[model samples]
Every structure is written in C-alpha cells, then in structure tokens.
Target: MSLLSFRVEQGDISRGCGFRSCCWTISRAVISSGILFRKKNQVKKGCSSVNDDLFVITDAPIHPEEVSAKVESRDAGAVTIFCGTVREWTKGRRTLYLEYQAYESMAVKKLAEIGGQVQDKWPAAKVAITHRVGRLEISDLAVVIAVSSPHRKAAYEANEYVIEQIKKVVPIWKKEHWEDGEQWIGDQLQQVEYPDGKPMKGSGTDD
Candidate 1:
C-alpha cells in the first residue's frame, strides 16, 4: 500500500481529523485512491504542522535555506536543494544582469501543480519551489527548489524533475541585459522569440 492511499471513513471525517492528523503513521493502510487530503498549505502531525509545499513567484531576493526548510520532515532521510542563478554570459554575449517576470497567479498555480505531480510519482517526497522575479544582477539566485524524501535517490530525481517541468510549463520569462542591449527571452529554453520585445501574451497580467 502506498503512503498516500487511504480511505477516510465518514466517521473519521466527522471527527475533524483525517489523513494529515497522522501523515507519517498511516503508511500501512489500504491502497485504493492515491490521494492524501491535507489542509491548504499545511500537513499536520500530532499537534504540530508544517507547510506541505511552498510555491511562490516573488520580487524579493530568494533565500535557499528558507525554501529548503519548508519541506523538512522527520520521515525524510534526504533533502535535495537546487538553486538556479543568473549567469554572467550566454553563448558569446556578455550579460550585465537579467530581469525576470511572470504571470504571478498562474505561475504559482503551475508550480503547485508540478509539486503535486512530484508527489504522485514519488509518494514519499515533499517539494517546495520559489522563483524570484524582477531584476537580478550577475550570479543572483533566480530560483530555488527543495525536495525531501525517505531516500536520496527519489529526493535527487524529484528535485531535478521539478526544474525541468517548471521550464516547460510555468509561464515565467527572463530578459537578458546584454552589454549592447536587452532582449526578452520569451522562453527560458530560447526556442520561442518575441520580435516586439515582450513576453508571449496569455492569461493574467504579467506583473
């Protein structure tokens, strides 16, 4: 039986205490549905609780340790943290700095969705992702991702998977401030280009 698979009887729900009340202790339950019902931002254990996942699109400088702490769990034997920083150059062009922007609401939603996918694939893993927007100087931390799991392999794989998935799905863009001029990188992969010098239009205002 998977740790996430559990059936909360009607009586259990009526008690106002469901899966989260004993997240770590109910691993031996039956496997029917692989969903773990948890409070909106938290998972409770006994009398205490911690954020189940952290997903944010912020304008402030991101602290890696702070993001990592969100996923810490006594059941996790390994936690993998990944920090992405602005580089000084891209290809042969020298970059002075970089500016990042995102459709904040949707980007955050996509981040949480990615976290949910991670949990589905690695049931024992918990993930947190924080991406910074606004201007970033050389070597500035742009994104931080942390994943904790009962083993190192799942933690490492899940952390790498999150970053790649974010790039492919999240609506976050970056502009390179070159020595000569600036260009909006429509897609982080650089496959899509914006001739008008803006992010690709979509839902929500890019703030």
Candidate 2:
C-alpha cells in the first residue's frame, strides 16, 4: 500500500471510532464509501507550473510519498498530506464497491486549476495531486494531495483548498455500489440521492 493509503486508513478509522464504538474498526474496514473552501476575488490567466509535478488521473494506486516528494525542497519545512480513500459506509448505506469514472483530460485540468488556486493564496506552497480512476475497492486510495511549504499552516490550508475544489469542479463521477443497489449519485457522503440515481435535470449525465 502507498503512504497515502496508509494515512487514509489510519485517519479515517480514528474518525470512525467516534461514530462507532466496538464496531468502529469493522465500520472503518467497510470504508468503500467515503472539507472546506476559500474565496477567489479574481481570475487567473493561466495554470501554474507548480502543479506540473502532477495533477493527474491514473488507474494505478496513488503513492503519497511520491506526491509529497514533489514538494520536498530544502526550503520546505512542513509537508501536509491529505489522502481521500474509499470507505465502507456512507450515511448508513453499505457500499460494496465503487466505480470511479472520469473525463480524464477534463479532470486533470481541473486539478491543475486547483493547484493554480493554491498558488494564488499560498505562493510559497507546492502541491501535487493524484486521483485514481476506474474501480476502487474498500479502503482504496481515491485521491492523495501533498502540499509542502515553509510553514505547516500554509501546507495544511493549501492541502484543504485543493481537495475541496476537486470535489466541486473536477468532472469525476463516482457510483456507489451498495448492497441494496448501485446509484450514480452526487455527494461522496451519499447525502444527495437523485431520483432513480440519475443526475438532476440540467445536471448532465454521468456519461
């Protein structure tokens, strides 16, 4: 498993412990199923070279260390890594598996866009993001974002910014393969279930 995969299992299980007591570990074991934003006052003209290290979509598992290494400069004192992994349950729903499909080029561009946004706020920070496409099993690493900076605060903030923007703008579709049924739905948490699990009108298809 990659470092990102490891961090995800560790962090999410810790969070799951709050939701479940004795079964917390089991609940986390099932994480085949499942942050913040900032304001942009102005538009940027072009993408940033800072993201050239990555901002990608791949079928292979993500390596968090590789992403983190992109920002590992002598100038960087802190590196904050955020790993988004596939979990077992979402809103009491039992997800057997998940299929992640994406408009690959579009998704990659959006990730680069997020990197540009991060540079706007935290100029000293460097970011690398990798989101796996195709099918992902429970506890699989879905996305891994690594941000490094001279200080820890900037790394943390930039890492969060990139993750949130990917959710909002990246043209990546995830279908929840649940025990009851599968649904190509919105929201990673399964909070928004459209009628018949189709995209909302004017929302476009998952095609």
Candidate 3:
C-alpha cells in the first residue's frame, strides 16, 4: 500500500499547520491498498465564508443533511442532492469494501473550480460538495452533493453536472476490494491509471 505525502504549507494553519504546534491527526487505519491509506484530518479544504457554497475533501463521514443545509435557501425553490455510496457488487464480483484516496489540495481546488463552472452555467444556482476519502464499507456514503436553484430543472441539471465534472477533473482515486483481490482502480471515466503504482503529482488524472 502507498500513501500520498503532503508538505504542509507554512501558513495554512486552517489545514492544521503553521507557527502553532497544532497539526492534522493521522488515522491509524492500516495501509491496505496499493493506492493509499485513509487518514483522519489528513487533507481538508473548503470555503471560508458564511455562504452555502462550499467544497471539501476529508476523511470523515459525510452527511447529506448537513451538506444540503449548507445550500438551503428560501429563494431556492428546489434543492437537489446526490449521494455516492460504496456498493457491495461491481460487475460480477462481490466487493468486500473500498479504499479512496486523493491528492487533497488539488482535489479541493478542482471541486471549487467545478462549482464555479456550475454557477457560470446556471447563474442562479448554489452548490455544496463534500467528498470523503478513506476506507468506506458497503453502503457507506462517499460523497454528498447539493445544488439549489430557483427552479427544479436547473437544480437537477446543475447537480448532475457537478458529479460528471468531478469524475473528469477531481484527483480522487478508488481501490476496489473483492473476494479475489484488490487494485488501484483509476478514475470514474476510466481515462487515467496509476501504472507506476501511484498517482502522478500535480496531474489532473493523478487521482
């Protein structure tokens, strides 16, 4: 198993690093995948304001209601949510579980970028995205996406768009474990692979 290492920025104390002694607490979960291990507070990035708009990457459990509340608004007639979960089966294989990892900094950046794109395409829409990275058991929520818009049509469309863009752009990778074995399966689009045994740093497809 491999773990992606991060160089904590000298001043990003919000990321748990700085002149202070506080730092991100690492998860004790064993590194069981060739992809990466899930660590507590390993990587976290998101909005720094009071608005509903947000983007986050973390190793914590994601709650749909919490995420949906972030994007809730009286003006928004419709609020759409998309929850991605770990399934027990894929193809013909009975999956045991899944391990997810990401290039945290870049993944959050891309997620924010996708949010920008959503707002650009649907100017009246507000979006919030929370993607969990780490070990996920069958039926566990891996991601919670919420999009609110003035109209239901716009909300649905924007919500779908966010996920599609995430698959194409976000640097999050999933390793599937089945009864047989496990492997570092690449992006959702199947357009990228970690042939060298790990994601390529600073690359869009590195996830």
Q: With candidate 1 superimposed using the best TM-score fit, by how many Å does residue 67's alpha carbon deviate from the native?
A: 0.4
lDDT of 2 by residue, 1-207 (tens): 222342221232113210121100111111221201122112121222223656767777766655555555666766676777777887688878778777666677778878888989999988878777678888887777877777766776677677667666777667778899887755432234555765543243232
lDDT for model 1, on a 0 to 1 scale? 0.64
Show the lowest summed lDDT stretch of 10 residues, model 3: 12-21
Q: What TM-score number comes out for model 1?
A: 0.72
For residues 1-207, what per-residue lDDT tens digits would candidate 3 score against the true structure? 334452221111111000011112111121123132234223233322212247887677776656665665657766666777776766677888888888777787788888899989999888988888788888787777778877877877787788778877887887777899777756665534565665556566543
| Regions of candidate 1 where Cα sits further than 4 Å from its true position | 1-53, 203-207
Compose the digit string of candidate 1's lDDT tens values, residues 1-207: 454344322111011100001012122122112233222233222221123347877777766656666776768776666777766756677888888888767787788889999989999999988888888888777877878888877877787788778777888877777899887765554345566888755522233
TM-score comparison, 2 vs 3, better candidate = 3
Global lDDT of each candidate: 0.64, 0.60, 0.64
- The deviation in Å at residue 69 for candidate 1 is 0.6
lDDT of 3 at 159: 78
In candidate 3, the residue pairs with backbone N, CA or C atoms under 3 Å apart (3 or more residues apart, or in different chains) clash, namely none
Our tally of clashes for model 2 stands at 7
Give model 3's TM-score versus the native structure. 0.71
